[model samples]
Target: MTELSNIPHALKGLNSVVVHPDFKFPDADVVLSVTGRCLYEKQLLVDTDIRSNHSESGGASTSDDDEDFHSQTSRDRRKEREEKNNPEKPSQATLFKVHKSVLRRASEFFADMFSIPQPSNQDTIDGLPIIYMHDDPIDIHNFINHIYNSDVLHYLPLRQSTFNMMSSIIRLSRKYLLLRLAPAAMFRIRSDWPTTLEEWDKNDLQVVAITRWNAQVRDGSQDGGSRLGPEDLLVEPCRVIRFARQENILEILPAAFYHLSRLSSLNDPHRPRSCIEGRKRAHGYWMGGGRYATRSVLTPADWDTLMIGKAEIRAWFVNFRQYGWQSIHATNCGADDPSSCVLSSQGGWKNYWDEVIGVQTRKILAQDGLDVMEVLQVLRHVVLYDENLCSGCRVQAGKIVGCARTEFWDCLPDFFRLKRPNPWGGIWMEGEPVDCFEQSI
Candidate 1:
């Protein structure tokens, strides 16, 4: 008989002792089998089988757990993708449109400030002018007076010089009014006032004012001197009132109130019967009562209208008079003048030498022509501001502020080519640069 210990534990666990027909157990009586050992081994085999069954059940649960983890990961990825595909909304800004009357008012206001002659007709572009205010060394009052005396009917020639002077003023004013009033744009012109006004209105501008003064002699002052004696200067005081619109009857309300307020404050027993006072006192009497009244009621709408009108006026003049005969002449002169011309057919070195040395020498030798200093001095009074900027850089530097450097630079290259100094230091130019000179600079 085989020892129970040597038999496999699982087979030993079978308690039934049956011998095969061909096999026999030797010494059945005398030789005894170890049943206890077989029983112990059999129990161990049964425990092992039970453990294997539990392991298989655990593996099935693990597979289900892996599937759940994979599903959660996919859900997270889908949520992330959805968020990326749709974004939040963005905010918007407000925009406004202006009326024409406002622009006309602004143009007129500027014109009044500079004492530029007012346009005589409703459709003519005559009252365009410039006002200079700032640290400009030039005397604005004197400059305006010179223009008045010179009999320069059209003002396009003054654009180059005036642009430099006026840019500073506009920049300063822009800074001052930025917080108080939002100005999206500004326009300036030296053309007929009526035409400018009409164009501005057509653009739905909000404000308008002319910076130049239209000169008008009092009815009796044809001979340069007043005919009446000092005591006999009893002249009827005159006041000019600008309406918002032809149909706007209420436009006069503010003007009337302003006039009444001034009248109440007057100390003179013979109070001037004028919205603006002192019309009867002197030959060159000037008053800006209308400005005080209008400025008090300035609004965003007013600014829009004013700016639109100015832009329209500028566009019109730029389109029509900018290339006119006078403009062409001035442009040509500026292009040819060694002092103003940036380029020449002779090359950069030759042009620089001629302008810096040759032309300067001639200027020193030339005798003084007219005492235009007086004229310059007088123009200072008429101009509200002045400034200068180089045509090379987009930003205008030097004592001027608030103007965008980029805008100034962009405007300069073309603007500088518009005017040229004569041999005597007078300005002239108005056309395109000569083709040969274009490549040399």
Candidate 2:
């Protein structure tokens, strides 16, 4: 039997996986043999040179082309001989001992499969029937663990490795029609990458706090070692974008795309290199003077979507800067000189934007255009707390912010050229959040 190295350790409180069949499962009546081709197996054969050393003879008539042809012919002959001599080789496989009732209850595919009658000649391992599964053993292990341990879904939101584990379960569940498991996994992903503006604002505040902490660390005012990064609080948007597109999770794409757009270093392969150094603020950020490349890149279509969405976002900012406060009426100003309050405060706001906010936006973002959502938050704070602005203007500014954020969230799908999904912003109850998983299940 061939041995496979680097088998993962069993997850906490779960032990349904084994690299070999020798390990016993007293309660398991069936053995699931999961097999996959070992990529390393062909490396030795491919690296070995099949050519023989030629003799150093001036009179030797074998041309260089002839030698090349002969070398390839010898390699082909050896491959044929090996194939004929060994028709089959033992493959690397993992054995999973699990219950039929658990599988049937979890998956429609397995339920239907178990309902079929089996032949008496079927292969058995240790007097138990062997079921061969072609999926990755890691996926199978996670799938079985989820079925046996209901707490897996219950504690999913709190787990640091939620994306990897939940995504694996989602892939397997979708394939096998595991009704309950997929919805739970989907709910967790959506919750993490919110669809509603209200929920996204909550997540954004956490990101802002992390950025502030990181900023303090960078300026030598705080311990550098104690700094927090965006990845600590949220999944990388590039990975989320790919996964959402693959699973048809339209609700998450707006936030994912918006998150990616805020990054200063997302570059078009066909575009110039002006913003490569700006990656420090985005997905593949720089840390401790070293570059850490993000794992995924957007597809061409996604790149187009990002560009369009960014253009729209920057355009919104420009429009807001020029005319967002035009609706403010002098009659609503609380100052004794209402006209002076309205005109002076408006002038103060625009001047502050041009001199401070605009310059800072240009400096920080560099090549990437304005981060519209973040700037909106900044605008909200400035209007509310700036001493120059009257209380009346502050209240009106709050209303404008509320309306703009809602409009932006609603138009995100249109911006990205995506068809909106049903329950786009999630279904909320009167005072409690509904169990989306139960309804879908």
Candidate 3:
């Protein structure tokens, strides 16, 4: 009894004293007791009695198990009942279903707003809900914004003409004109001016030529002199018009204005005729005046009929697929080998050689050719192009050409050298040389 009392007193002292500053009292004592119990059990000096009690409710309870089985069971039952009763329970399928409904509603709302009937054949592709509107530029722009903002449309493929038409509508609306013009000025500086000049000859190229010629004429003559050189005479707007045709300006100005109008109306809600009926009415006035027009609007019913037409949709798909295939094949063929036939390149090979080779390679290799190197190259091109090579492959091709002697073969993957020589004879795991006797002769 005295020994037992001394043992308890010794345990209290051990529990009270901190083993380490980081270690707490109750936790350390509990750990030490558990360790001792485990050792005693291992030595057969003490047995760990894992007694389980079968409760009156047919539930089992174990020693040291703090969880109340009755309470857990009750809670689970309540949750099940709540889930069954609740109509708005969050679920993936439900969320998707709700999204689909919301998109449909939004489409209907916009169609009504524009006085255009929705496409009857409204369908979903790969979880993306599509709403086809009448090809009215304003209505189309609004619809694009609507779907884009709502996150209903995942991918949009618009015809170039359609995009241009919408842009013109936006520009004429006057809401985004200045902002649109700002970007247009930059674009003119970067691309349009250079391209236009390249297309024209000396007589046709007026703006830059006139400006330069005038400056030269001013510099060549005395400061206040009125007498001009032949170049200076050419600098006059009247002379420039006569050199070209006045009709060219008339033709170009309307088209430019049309596109500008479309661009300006893009984000402006206050812009009138930014809807199907409004655009159609506007077109009626414009067309009645005997002006050359690229597009004419239709009634809501007519628009819906057009949108739902199988042939039209099929044509769109065909064009889109062709364009995508051409773009991809162009990249693949033009890549590395500059001489290869790509659609973007000037006349080289008559057909896509890379695609032909790719098909044959697949038949031979029995696997996809796009591996880690191809993936890495794609990533490198996307990320490193602008920073390193102005987003053009010309510099990369040049580098390859410069490093052709040693780096060319080294750059190629092991699989590409399937026919390369194995010095260990036929016993080696690696393949034979590409120009081996069996392959060559």
Q: What does the lDDT read for residue 267 in candidate 1?
A: 27
For 42-81, candidate 1 gives per-residue lDDT tens digits of 1111011222343465511223322332243336545444
lDDT of 3 by residue, 29-114 (tens): 11111111011111111111212222333332332222321133436545545556764553111001113332334444432433
* TM value for model 2: 0.63
* Best-fitting candidate, scored by lDDT: 2
Model 2 is weakest, by summed lDDT over 10 consecutive residues, at 41-50
Model 2, residue 83: distance off in Å is 21
Q: Locate the minimum summed-lDDT window of 10 residues in model 3.
A: 33-42
lDDT value, residue 57 of candidate 3: 32
* CA-RMSD of model 3: 36.5
TM-score for each of the candidates? 0.15, 0.63, 0.15
Which scores better on lDDT, 2 or 3?
Answer: 2
When 1 and 3 are scored with lDDT, the better candidate is: 3
Per-model tally of clashing residue pairs? 84, 0, 18
